[model samples]
Target: MAEEKNSIHEELIDETVATETVEGEAVEASEIEGEETISLEEQLKIAEAQTKELEAKLEEAENRYYRIQADYENSRRRARLDLEASEKYRAQSLISNLLPAMDNFERALQMEVDGEQAASILQGMEMVYRGLLEALKNEGAEQIEAVGKEFDPNFHQAVMQVDVEGFDSNHVVEEFQKGYILKDRVIRPAMVKVNQ
Candidate 1:
């Protein structure tokens, strides 16, 4: 009876120890699972931050591209305006050369007027001629100097050389036809008679 009682006590102690070991192992496994959850949360937060940073960089790149495109459009518009202005004034030099001929027409009309109606017609034609000249002059048209000035090959052409008593040599004696300049460049050289 005494040996049986001792054996029963030893078996109860072994069972208690086994139960304690199993509880300890379960607690350790729970702790490892908690650590793994925390690590996964940290990785998620890092990924979210990287996504935001990439979005910001993409927005900045898009803004720069739009600004460059706007600048190019503005440059193209300005070039077109400049080209239009050039086309409008393309024939300014040629029309300016015709001013002297118009003046001669006006003088002839004035000297040959016979009646009130005739004089009125001549005045109307002169007005038209003046309007045409004014329009050309406003667009970079200018007349070249010829008569009574020193002969310059840059602005004048000697159609005939004349021996004049009073004028110095190489002086412009007469302008047969007027010349014209445009924007400081001689478009048509003055046809003149130069002194010998």
Candidate 2:
């Protein structure tokens, strides 16, 4: 009977040790699972940060693209306006070159002729002057009326001021050189004497 009791006591000790080992293994497994959950949360946080960074870069790139597009539009508009202005004044230089020749013609026409040959030459010159005037008129150019008109600085340049009979104050008394208008723009202002 004593030997049987000893054997029963040893068996109970062994069973208790086995239960402790199993419980320890379960605790270790739970710890491993908790670590895995924490690592997953950390991974999610890192991914969120990277996504936000990429979004910021994308917004910056979009803003840069918009700015470049606006600049290109403005440059194109400016170039178009410049081209239009150039077209509007295409004949300016040619008209400017003809003014000195017109002045010479006027001076020659004023000379007195004393003989038949001289008078015939003068008649031919007058015809040429008329033809020149007609040609200028056809090109949208016209002489500014300065003599006996109001002295406007836009069309007349006052070179001399005088008190003249039969003329109002601030009126053009005599034109030294004729002014001309090419289209709507003034090519030259008339050099004139103004009445005081």
Candidate 3:
């Protein structure tokens, strides 16, 4: 009877030891799972932060690109305008120089003819004057009409005021010097006598 009691006591001690070992292993596994979960959360947070930083950089780059494109378009437009302006006024200097020669031609044609030779010379002068006027017209130079028209300060310069039977008030009675326009811009104003 004592031997049976000792055997039962040994069996109880072994069972206790096995149960403790299983409990210890379960606790260790739970600790490992907790550490893995924490690590995954930290990794996820780091990845999200990096994504936000990259998105900010991309937006900044896009903004800079749009600004540069706008600047380029403005510059291109300005350059085109400058080129057009230069082209429009290209013949200004030559036309200005030729004005005196044109005046001389008109003076020559206005003289009286006393003989056949003088009449022939006048005819030749008229032809030359017509040719010069046609050439000037082709180059976008045009004469401003002054005589018999209302006096305008933009195109006509009043040299004197005159009382005339046929002319109305503020009308140009006579044009002393012809005005010229080049491409919608006035090169010279006509010298005129305005009727009061």
Candidate 4:
């Protein structure tokens, strides 16, 4: 009966050892799975870092887009201003072409006359001269008067000089060709003789 009891005790000890071995194997497997989980976590962190980098690049791209848009808008504004300026100055060439006619009128008006028919022609020429002057004035044309004034190199060109008593030196004595201005800028300098 004692032998039977010892055999039963040994069987129970063997079964306990087998169960402990199985449990040890299961613990080792769990450790390997934990290592794999840690590697997966590292991969996820790398992906997150890449995503942040991409977001920063996108932000920079968006900033560049806004700058380009602003540049385009400024270019458009400048173009509009230039077009308006060109339109405003469109009549300058036409007015410049009519200056010779004005000179002819001045010469005709200065000619001597001795009859009623000549007087009538003179009156008609005066009317035409006044009309032409008015039209030029309306289009921003101005005349520079140099006679009896100080000779300024900016507005007057000295063609000849004469010694004159009782007149200030370097003063304009006669205007040869009248100077003209357009939009406050001198288009032609006055040709004049200066008193020496």
Q: Score every model by TM-score.
A: 0.47, 0.65, 0.66, 0.64
Query: Pick by TM-score: which candidate is best?
Result: 3
- Model 3 over residues 45-164: C-alpha lDDT tens digits? 555566568779999999999999999999999999999988998887889899999999988888988999999989999999999899889889999999999999999999999899
Model 4 residue 142 lDDT score: 83
TM-score of candidate 3 on Cα atoms, chains taken together: 0.66
State how far residue 20 of model 1 sits from its true place (Å).
Answer: 54
> Which residue pairs show collisions in model 2?
none
lDDT of 4 by residue, 29-63 (tens): 32343433234345446555666687799999999
Give the Cα lDDT of each candidate.
Answer: 0.72, 0.81, 0.82, 0.80
Q: 10 in model 2: Cα distance from truth in Å?
A: 58
Residue by residue across 18-125, what tens digits does model 1's lDDT show? 322354553333234343323434544555566568779999999999999999999999999989867866876567566667658656655777899988988888
Question: Lowest-scoring 10 consecutive residues by lDDT in candidate 4?
Answer: 28-37
- Steric clashes per prediction: 0, 0, 0, 0
Clashing pairs in 4: none
Task: Flag the better candidate by TM-score, 2 or 4.
Answer: 2
